[model samples]
Target chain A: MFKKKHPLQSKSEILLRNIVVTAMIVFFLVFLIIPIGIAFVGSFHEWNPLSGTYRFLGMENYKEVFTSSLFGRSMINTLIFSVVVIIFRVGLGLGIAYAIYSPFIKYKSFFRAIYYMPIVTPMVAVAFVWKFMYNPQIGTINHLLGLNINWLMNPKTALLAVMIMTIWKDFGYAVVMYCAGLYSLPSDALEAAKVDGANGRQVFLHIILPLLKPMTLFVVITSIISYVQAYVQILIMTEGGPGTSTYLASYIIYDEAFVKYNFGYASALSFVLFVITAVFTWCSFRVSGSEE
Target chain B: MKKKIMLIAMVSALSITSLAGCSSESNKKEQTKIDVPTEVFGDTIKYDPNVEVNNGEKVTIELWEWGSDELFESLIAGYTAIHPNVTIKLVNNPWEDYWTKLPLALDGENGPALFNIHNSYHENLINYLAPLDIPIEDLQADFTGVDAHIIDGKVYYIDYGMMTGTVYYNKDMWEAAGLTEADIPKTWDEMREVAKKLTIKNGDQIVQAGLNFNGDFHQNYLLGLNYQLGENIFKEDGTTPNVNSDTMKQIMQMLVDFYEVDGVGSKDFGEKGADSFGQGQSAMVIQWGHFYNTLNTTWSDINFGVFEIPTFDGNPYAYNRYNGESTFGINKNAPKDQQAVAQDFVKYYLANDNVQVAFNLAMSTFPAKKSLANNEEILKNPSLRVLAEHIDRYIWPGPMPETVENSLKRAGEEVFYNGVDIDTAFDEAQATIEKDMKNSSFVSVENLYKYAK
Candidate 1:
């Protein structure tokens, strides 16, 4: 009856449909899918940009990227930056959401607007403004604190400085997400916790924290993805300065492709980053699976 | 009901047509016209008469002209009048980003038909460069970069024209020190003495710099002088870095002494090197012939005098580290006729005295050809003549060695800016270069020229 209603297509009709879809799909595959796929394949090969010769040397790029000090350092820098960023951002986001979610806070809308400002601000522009604010000699922070720090230039502090900016710029979104989670929480749970002689801290730890796990996972996963793809902050602030101390995987790929004209190498580097992101994303979902 | 359906479809189609028209119109505007300002070279030359069009090919070539595009467009306008078949489309960007993007675009499948390459990147673009295939004798026959473009036994690029660095001094500041252009110092010691006089200190902070030394200016301050010292940084073979050598150390120390021991360029002053010249923050600065051109445009009324850059450590020839040199090569993939026209245009731009005059006039830079540099009209011109004397020592600092070019320059910046020891900073630079060289696949300059014709 369904086949009769749909009227099983003739061979010619199927052929014509396939031809049209195939044409459109070929366009996409050639333009988008092919480049991305090639990037993945490129990671297994040792290709020289200038010579236009490629050697298929499986796992060497991965080996080199893992063993090379430059890549290793950048990886560590990226991880430390991400972990610190998540902690501060999620922590600050929850604090802000809770404070504002309370009945007593004044000018909630104004505070919300202020919090949203960095989220809406362009990443490049925010990084640039932050660059000056973290300038070694002239930065307002350094001058005010009377602490001599090369915030952007010094290897020791550059990552932290970058992470701080990342947190400030991104936490607003996390806050907004947490707000939704807080609103969705059952008011009866909080009331029951209070009736059980729980303080604000006890209620937060025992009742609110468990409820926010789903929102936290969402924020954390997205934040991790964003941090892995972090290029603009490093580009604008340091350009991976002070001896590759702040070089991240994304910026390395960017510099290789654009600055150094080693597109082959850059493509390979990108695939490695893609794999890392994919795995991390998978693990995140796995960890958050039962909690939801 | 049928009429209503048709009317809705027609309205939607009309809106789509208008949108498409608007986009196409904007693209037409983007494609046709480009404007750019040039540093004011004091001497003005005639404009290019026309783009060289042959056999009425009616060629439309894409050009990625970084700066001075408008002036080039004007010159092309004059050329198009002569040969209406050929049209030139010029696009420009800031010099810094242009170097980054243009190469990738040029190497891409659908990049420009013609583009710019600077001396700093001579080695980097060699493989991508399509051979001009002009035989050896015919190439640079007039010394118009026959050798400059020759790479691994083939012609790859030609200098747009050339300029050497010179000390374009502030006459106003020099006058305060009771020094006339006639009394301009020829040696570093005399220059420093004058600088000490020009140096003004209000309390502790540097009020005005006597001379602005671009810190981390390894090539300009040290390498140039090293060339004068008869020390070649790269072995003629180009493989081994003699950077840790005694001569290198001596050169490094001399530069270090200027900022540290002599104390001329200050960290506290905070005036950037590029801006210090025009802003009157520095009394004397050594930069390319374009500085005079820039001063002429931006600070025309400001009293300034142009002179030769001083020799360091009694070498009698001061080497200003080479930057901002350009080479043009045909796209290997472009049409046959376009290549011929490009070659003729370059030959004309470098050879024809009138175009040389226009280049100098419009761009405030010099004609790269030896013939024009020696021309009495060009030689008599105050700004460019002194720069010509230093041409023998002009080097691209060995094509901006991947090992040394400023990725790590920012790292050692603190040492220069905060008086970090020279040894410490040099070691860091050395380490970074070594690491970069290891990661990089390109052979050293020594190995690169093994195929030299």
Candidate 2:
């Protein structure tokens, strides 16, 4: 029985499968593995591509990145931005998903489409729109609210302003994901909870929430990785300014590589960022795996 | 087994093709080196417009610029019209991305053959620029301020225009405040007095800013003010920064007082000086000569006038430091034929007086050509006219390190937004700049300017 094969599993089919698998492996090696390998190797040198010069510096680039005050500030900013955006975005998305998933809700598809609209919209366009709306004097937010706050220029509020915009533009994605999770939940378990003296709140808190853990873990881990690498909004809106108030680790990497032409140092910074992202992702898996 | 062999054979063939695509062209023929004249313009060798470039081979030269796309397009049109075989392709990137993309582009084989250069980035870009083969004396005789650009008896690029900070006043706001030409400020004290009259408030909120330096203090104000106070921001060695001095503190305090003590401006008034002024939210802004064109193009309805920047006491060592609006440099890494064609096009550009006047006017800069100083079209711009009158009062500091500007900007922010003391800010800035200069390849140009009055 184990040696038996399907009629379609002929020599030509096996050869075709081998070719497809080989093609995919080659593609990944060329596009992804090779670049990562180069970055790893380039991290130890002082590389100036313009002059085609590379001088090995041992661990000097890494040491500088670790000791630099700007990098420290950038890390702190990134952590703050990521943590706050994750909490609010996840919380808001779950609540909206629950509300829309209920049978009592009308025009559910319309509401879902509205929430998903921002997810499909381009980040650059969204960032620009938010930047205009945040203008202190002539912005829609200020004009409507009758307030005179310099949203992007005030150091105290710059990071908070950026986080708010990021959450608004990104929470819709969470909503869509959570909605799919809620729909796929086992109905029998929820019905049993309802029958066993469990109220709607109790059912949701215990049965629904517990079952959605897999989806929640997936959402949280992806969000952590995405937000950790987030720099486009920062680039478009603040440019890490109001004096580096919104400076994230990713923005620093971009600045070091492109603006300063310190590719070696930037590669070192990128590796550090990669390590941090991996550590967080590993811990997330461990925690979720332990619960299972 | 035969099918498996065939599969392996096909995979090997695909892998070889992909590796070949990634490999460099080792088998290609070497490019022939074209001879560049040691003396491009002299008694025997003069610029000839009819000289065939690239040995009359049809060629396309890519030219990159951060701005003045229209001017370059028209120039390309003019050049191609004369030499029908040559096609000049123009690639324009925004100012912010140009610097970041330029070096990487130049490193590649398909980069532009010619591109614009800014003095601030010249130190880093020096290695990539092919020095002008023209004799130093010829450039000195033809262009003004070429001395500052000459390094080791070779000029990489010449400044086609001179630019410095100037006060742009909203003419409507000035008239509304009952100010006339006689009331135009000649000194800082007088400007403050006039600014107070123009400022409008709506119950503790500044509805209109008389003058704003929210974002430009580092570039336009601080860098220029020290020269007026008989001081240079850098030490005599030029490489060592000397920003933590009595003169710098005085300048920082004056800027702080503009918002905190004097009530003439506020940091929260607007995002940038030029944007606020264009929107009529600011009565005055300290901007460069290029703002003249910006206002005409972006905000044509706004009536504005230009005046020279005010002195501290109506007399000083110099008014401000000037930066060269440099011309394009040919890429040394480009193919020999492309480089030759680029050089020939540059020669054609400089030799034509009408083209010089047009370039300067389009950029709103003072012309570098001595012959074009009196050109009627060039003098038509009010900003250039003001620049012409006070051109000698401005000093060219040569190519400054970007670190100097960044450090000063950080110091300004620390003082204004971070609540750090002025002395501490300056000290930190000095320390940062010193470290950056020591680590980088920047060697300051000494005697670029004379500060003695």
List each candidate's DockQ score.
0.19, 0.29
Error of 2 at B132 (Å): 1.6
lDDT of 2 by residue, B1-453 (tens): 323322322332232222233322321111011122222332211466467777777999899998655456556655675577898888999998888788888877888899988878875678888988677787778887887777788888998888888899999999998999899999999988988888998887888888898888998988988989888766787667778889988999999998888787788888787899999889999998878878876788899998889999888788887887888889998999899988888776776554566677666778878777876766778888877776767877667777678778878877887778999889888887786665565554436554443
Q: Which fraction of the native contacts appears in each prediction?
A: 0.16, 0.30
Q: lDDT for model 2, on a 0 to 1 scale? A: 0.80
- Residue pairs of candidate 2 with colliding backbone atoms: none
Q: How do the residues B1-453 of candidate 1 rate in per-residue lDDT, one tens digit apiece?
A: 323322322332232222333454543343243222122111222123333357676788777767754345545543454566878777787886776566566677656666777656654556556776456565546544445445677766655555656676778888887977677888878887877777777775566778776533543454555555555555555544445456656765665676667777664343245466577777877666666656766666667777776776555432544443464656666666777766655543443344445455344456665556676646655677766665555544345554465633543454554355666656655655564555443333322221221
lDDT of 2 by residue, A1-292 (tens): 5986676658899889889999999999999999999988899998766545588999999998999888999999999999999999899999999999999999988988999898889999999999999988878988998888898887888899899999998898888889999999988998888789999889989999888888889889999999999999999998888666788999988877776667888999999999999998888889888444
Chain B vs. true chain B: TM-score for each candidate? 0.77, 0.86
Interface RMSD of each: 4.7, 2.0
> Chain A TM-scores, all candidates?
0.82, 0.95
Model 2 misplacement above 4 A = A1-8, A290-292, B1-46, B55-57, B450-453
Give candidates' CA RMSD values in order. 10.8, 11.7
Give the best candidate by lDDT. Answer: 2
Docking class of 1: incorrect
